[model samples]
Target chain A: MSLITPEFGLLFWQTLIFLLLLLLLAKFAWKPILGSLKEREDSIDNALKMAQQAKEEMQNLKAGNEKLLADARKERDQMLKEGQAMAAQFVEQAKTTASAEAGRITQQAREAIQQEKNAALAEVKNTAAQLSVDIAERLLRRELADPTAQQKLVDEYLKDVKLN
Target chain B: MKRLLTLLLCLCTFVGFAAEPAESGEKGGAFNPGEIILHHVADSHEWHWFSTDNGNFVTYLPIIAYQPGKGVAAFSSEKVAEGKTYGNFKLEDEKLVAIDGSKVYDFSITKNVAALAMSSLLLVFIFSSVAKSYRSRVGQAPSGLQSLLEPFIVFIRDEVGKKSIGPKYERYMPYLLTVFFFIWFNNLLGLTPGAANLSGNIAVTMALAVVTLLITLFSANKNYWGHIFAPPGVPWPLYIIMVPVELIGVLVKPFSLMIRLFANITAGHIIILSFISLIFIFRSAATGLISVPFGLFISLLELLVSILQAYIFTLLTAMYIGGAVEEHHHEEEHGHGEDFGTAEQRAGGSNVAHLNRPDVATH
Candidate 1:
């Protein structure tokens, strides 16, 4: 190495130049650059905000869908209950009408039987009276015809009849 | 006009005092080019007496001596007198050697280095305070330091981290922020007088570059290695040729980072010093007067560059980290035939017989 080293003249000048260049950049260039960076940051914030909003909207839509589904289920259940009640009511009405019709048919059947019995009874009474009248007529006729003969026959029959 | 006249009077006095010819036998009072450069750039710790408080309490500014052989030396202007025994001062072996009877001392001061250290500490304090503010307000809008740092934080997150490193970038944010702030703070400090040449030192830049290199090497995934070695779709011969080149590329990346920072910073300093040196070189009072305006203009320009260099350095570092940590994906052809038959056939004896049979099946 040389006894007298070269002074840092070059280094000093270089450093000064670099510093001046830096100052220029700070004044003129940095504003635009930093501004761009800030813009980028703002955009990122907006994106995050948008994402949060979308998530909230999705949650709201899900809740709404669930509510709609629940309402539809409730309506279906109500319709089902009404339909069941109507069906039960129709069944009860049909049962009552069927029972009433059966009662009427049974009464009619009993009346028909009673009428037939009454008719038969009336015929039997008429027949019995007619038969008795006919027999009485024949017997009287026989007695009248035999009266002259009967006096002689009676005298003979009287001796055969006991006096008690 | 009065300020200007006073400034002119001062310049005339300084020139007259500095340019006085030496004794006939001694060399003329001419400063060497090397001495001139060192006087401007080197650190000094001595207290120069400047009158500010009407000479009640003298203000002291550091003055660096333009030692011929020695790099730079600190001498108190207050202590300097006209031929007052010149005691305890010795130039030995081209270095400023001081001998106080039996004790020897080197006239070097650590004040500039301390200033640089203190500047770094200040950066730490400011950033930490900003971070604390952010933490305290969980959901509220940012204010004060939070407002200032929030923009930078988000920019790094979205532009540097997200765009460069993609989704899995949160883990690297701390390192990026630290690097960005550290470099930026150091660069700004270097612009101040009597501060350590942190970024200008090649060793410091090398250390930073090494950190980036280590991170890149260790964090590199299998895909990165695969790309370097085999390089998808590249012919085997070409890939063999490219492997060493790609490996060398890894080393070159950090080397470039080291050089870029070191060169840029050192160049700026040299340019500024050169402009200032013009004043002494002309020796003409008129030339020196003309140079003052130009020097002021250059000083203004250097202020802007101080921030730009910092930004450029940080951006490049981010890009390098991004490249290292990025994920790569490859798509395979859908209908390619299988290289091997079914496992059973490959394992069985009948498959061995079929393997021996040639084109008889084709006929």
Candidate 2:
């Protein structure tokens, strides 16, 4: 019977002790401990967030570098292709100019040969006419060697010219 | 095997020594196990460690009694040893009584009060040092005693506080932590041989329960009172019975909490004492074979019960606070349409599909 009953003295002490404990612990113990725990959690969370941000920034930087490298490669290829085309054009132009020079020289030589052949042909014709004139003059002189023949030839030529 | 036999022998030797005085002291040659067990479990002015034929090992506590007409008188309890009387007072069945037929209020430093003081001091020392460590070792891992108790503190915070009290749990943490460790430490202390049964006492448990009840009542929101006074969805005709029942339920929660812890710890002590009494009741050394092992087993069980009761008390306190301060949610109101779905709402969720089914089916 006594075991189940509550005593006033014990109750008073129990309540006093408990309330004091609650106050003391709340002020001195739990406040500091819980505050530190929350602070530690926040610090850790911040560290992880910063690490994630840094990783994203590194990825963006890498992507930008890759894009720049690709653009540089494309530009180099463009320059290389232009250089090759220019070299090809220079060779073609040089070949065309050499062919034109050769053609002009050959035409000039052919014109000079035609002119010499014409001059040579004219000289040969003039020499043949001169030789014929000299031969005729010698033949006339031999025929008039006889005077009476010559005079009768002159008189008959004269009577014929008068009768006409 | 040899060690174990020696330890058992030591236990038997202790039981034999402790039981003889109970058998021979007050009741002639006969042994009264009930009297012995009750004396051990009850509060007293003297701390009795053990008894032998030569003498008894005891510490007489201080007595402070206040008479209505007269002022307070303080003296050593040794002045009233073995049916003796002091100046105007006498010891009556380990209680202080006045000889002049007047009522005296005893505010002595009884066994339980002393034990409470010791345990509280110990708690303050341990926690203050731990608190200091937290200050000194900022941003570093807890070491030594700090490391050991940190897990339990976190468990009570996260598991008990956060889970029970929801978002506003921080406000009630100081009370929760203090009560948890106080109960736990005292429970463990009570398990020591010849120690005071401080936590098992009804007055101590009552004080704790009263604190919990007060906190719950003070922190209770409008929603909590609303649910109690006028339950949602209940017809007005049922309010006559429902209102009284709801009010009683509020009280019964704390009342049950008090009795549960008190009965558990007291029952553990009685069972252990009863087991030791078995050897004396039979008056044989062979009975020790059964009594010693059973007593040891119950003591170990009591160790577990100690922490378990502490956890339960704190958890229920947190739950009560949680219920009191919980904000009204529309989903919970919907669930209350079903008569007994509040518990189910708490268990599963506020949004049970079955709760919404009737409205949907009608539509």
Give the runs in model 2 whose Cα sits over 4 Å from its true position: A70-164, B1-23, B26-28, B99-101, B332-363
Write down the worst ten-residue block by lDDT for model 1 chain A: A1-10
Report the number of the highest-lDDT candidate: 2
TM-score of each: 0.48, 0.76
Candidate 2 docking classification: medium
lDDT of candidate 2 at residue A137, scale 0 to 100 = 49
- Highest DockQ: which candidate? 2
State how far residue B212 of model 1 sits from its true place (Å): 1.1
lDDT of each: 0.55, 0.82
First chain TM-score, candidate 2: 0.62
- Model 1 ranges with Cα > 4 A deviation: A1-164, B1-29, B33-35, B38-116, B239-241, B288-290, B330-363
